[model samples]
Target: MEVREIALGAGESYELRLTGRGARGYVWTWQVTGNADAVSVSEAAPPPAQTLPGAPLERAYVVRGRSPGGRARIRFAQIRPPYPQEAPYDEFVLEVEVTAATGGP
Candidate 1:
């Protein structure tokens, strides 16, 4: 899968273009979240460093689902990046760049 990191301020927008072949009718979304700190470490010590809440400070997005057994191509230009300053809303534009592919000789 391929992920892209984009930077934008509040009220700003970005255009995301996607074109690929796949079983039509696949659902995809552009999600946004704010995380003060990631609880990546499973274990916890006496002093369990800093912690943040589990609420998405601010979120906004739009998506277009794919159609199964068909091609998927679309252009999205209605996105306004959030500004979760308190939580450092560093957006992560993650998409299933490649779901499946047939072999060739």
Candidate 2:
């Protein structure tokens, strides 16, 4: 699995973009952790998946935000094809981290 890490500044929003080719589509899972409240994050439409050899699938999610001076890490997981005879699309993994506030709260 390929992994990527992202950093976020205060009041900053980000999108996880997916690229490359292959089939069976993708599966994604994310979690946010921080001392801030859950309102600090805003996630837009999830990136589209690369078409694979089998079915066409779609999945999306929004990240919960946090309070000031808090940090969060969002992780994404890739979905694979079922049959052993099927070709594999490029697998993916990601981690997004929001930077804590600069000054003391």
The residue-by-residue lDDT of candidate 1 on 1-105, one tens digit each, is 344543332222334433311122221223322321210111112222242333222222333222222222222222222422233112234331112233459
Among these predictions, the greatest TM-score belongs to 2
- The window of 10 residues in a row where model 2 has the poorest summed lDDT is 20-29
lDDT of each: 0.27, 0.46
Superposed on all Cα atoms, the candidates' RMSDs to the truth, in angstroms, are 17.9, 6.8
Let me know the TM-score candidate 2 reaches against the reference structure: 0.42
Query: Residue 70 of model 1: what lDDT?
Result: 26
Which pairs clash (backbone N, Cα, C closer than 3 Å) in model 2? 23-52, 27-79, 36-67, 37-66, 37-67, 38-65, 40-65, 40-66, 41-65
What lDDT does model 1 reach?
0.27
Best by lDDT: 2
